[model samples]
Target: MNMFLINFSMLWSFSFFFIFIYIITIFSIIIYIIPSLKNTINYTKFKKNSNFDYLTGFDLYFLLLTPLILFLILNFSWSSYTISAWFGNIIFSSFQYKIFFFIFFFYSLILTAYCSSFYFHSKEIYDYTITIFNFFFWILFLFSSNTLFTVTFFIEILSTLIFLMLATSTFSTTYFYNNLNLNLHNYFNPTTPFFFIQMLMYFFWISLISSLNLFFFLILFYLKFLTFDWFIFEFIFYFLTSTFTLKDIFFSLFIWFNLLFSIFLKCGLVPFYFWKPIFFKGIPLHALFFYICFFYFFIFLFFIYFLLIYMNEIFFFFLIINLSLLIIGIFILLFIICEAFYLKAFLAISSIINTLFVFLALNSTNFTDFIFF
Candidate 1:
């Protein structure tokens, strides 16, 4: 018990320190990039009413996120090697710990770049690239982590907050540009070069907080100060994410149970449809459907949120049944929707396939139920 506690304590401390370094790195990039930006600022172009070159802000943030991301990846790589070398052939306890740092660092970078670039290049080409990258990076991140439930719960919260911010900000920006007649290109774009940087800061800060909270949660559980809520949360997520038939009996039962559990805890689930309509209205049509479907798809996430508050054995089985249904329904849904819409067809198809595969595996007896709770 002492040895386990000691290792747990060290992991918590190391995770905190790693996050600290990560924050410093982002701030350093902002500080470094600002000067070059000031030097490049051309008042004459603004004064003459020329369209602000989209590439400038894009290039600056790209350069900023790129090098630091590379550096972080390098650090994770080196740290992993150091652990292996020190431990020789033994399965060191720190093996998974070291991998989490790498996974976190890489996923953060991919998300930052995806966010930064998506703003400037509204072209279908770049948008899809970034989405694909983010999706794959998220997969790798979840796959590599040592503690699935802790990481996933953190990710779900982070994603929810980010989507809400996006929905709000996009609404505000669109309103300002269309109604107020503010030039989104000249007046707003150049002045707000730090937009992506601010988001990066916010995301990093939240991740740090979540990491700390995870440590405390684990420690308390270890000391028998709290019960492990992992099974409940994880089970719900696995069911909701993996299930296929959306409007079916099994699906409705899951949602009903989730709502019941949420009410019990006094934490209500957001009416997901309300959030997505505004979010989709702000983006291009192709992107609109994409965002809407993605948001709609996660309505199942309510199960996870509710599970965090209350755990019942029946909740776990309900999750599995719904997930099995969801898997089959999503693939057929995709085939129909993609054929009808014909927009961002590749991503549309990919989303369905990916969703189906995740669900199919979830229902299969061989699948791991580790990511929930």
Candidate 2:
């Protein structure tokens, strides 16, 4: 009787989380679809006089498809949340939630691949048509959760590999076309700093995220292959990123204040000097186009990242604070780069250095215990 009661209580809590996520998805879908609700995206003004031709067929296809893609994905996402949240029910526990996560992972993976392919080769209609197929895939996958149409894991893996191969092929073709073979005449010159700095930015950005994903999957694999510790670390990290409150804010400020200082005020200062002139000279259209490919890549990765954050079951305050400070530092760097003013560059760098030191001190000591989920 006591065990039964405990199980029931957990089911109730799970149901609450499910409803909350469902509400979020519904709201997000509505906001994404309703143009009046969206904040105006000023891409036209930002790119005016740029060499790119005005709105191509590819652009029209992209605009028309994005909302539908987002909607179907979110819709299936909510359904999966429902089953996982309610899976404490005895009859559903064995395969429902396991299949749920697998399907969700693949769904996101397919969307990501399609988006990447589009980013690279916008001229292909057959590639774009795959986006429409995702809508039916969502429905079939969702219905399979409760009823018929369940696919074998081997088949699922095969399908995923196909999508990945397509994405790789398209991405390589695009990259090959776009990269110019320009030899550096003066590797030791001041101009070289620009190339090195950009490389550093890309490295750090990729490294931080790749590490996070690697750690996450490690936990998953270990649990499945070894003993089940219930992946407590995964839960802790997820909770920290997704849940927010005044308490989280306070904890973040107290823990990461110094690192924040150094990154924004110190580390980025010299870089700002390099970037200001670069920005005014303007990003090359071809370079911008290459970056657009990268931009889509990052967005796809971020979607996976935050999706993990939302689903993970643990709580950690320090991680969230550090991430927030990182965001602040990025904004400061962007501001300095946009300003193109040397004085502002100096001030921004100085301030960020001080901030970084403070964050360093806070991180060195143990103050995150006060953090609450």
Q: How do all models score by TM-score?
A: 0.40, 0.27
Q: What's the TM for model 2?
A: 0.27
- Which runs of model 2 end up more than 4 angstroms from their true locations? 1-55, 58-231, 234-373
Worst 10 residues of 2 by lDDT: 146-155
Compute the lDDT for candidate 2.
0.37
Give each prediction's root-mean-square deviation over alpha carbons.
Answer: 12.6, 16.1
Q: Candidate 2 lDDT, tens digit per residue, 136-215?
A: 23333332332111212212332343333333333233433422232222222322234334434543443344334434
lDDT tens per residue, model 1, 1-373: 2456546545655664456447545654564444336448742322233232233335444554565467456545644433321112112234344544655565455445445544432223332433333433333333333333444443454355444444333332332343232213222243232333344455444445545554544454343313333444445455556778575445445444443433222211111111121122233333334343433233333334333334434444655446554554555464455232323333434444554564445344533453352
lDDT of 2 at 339: 36
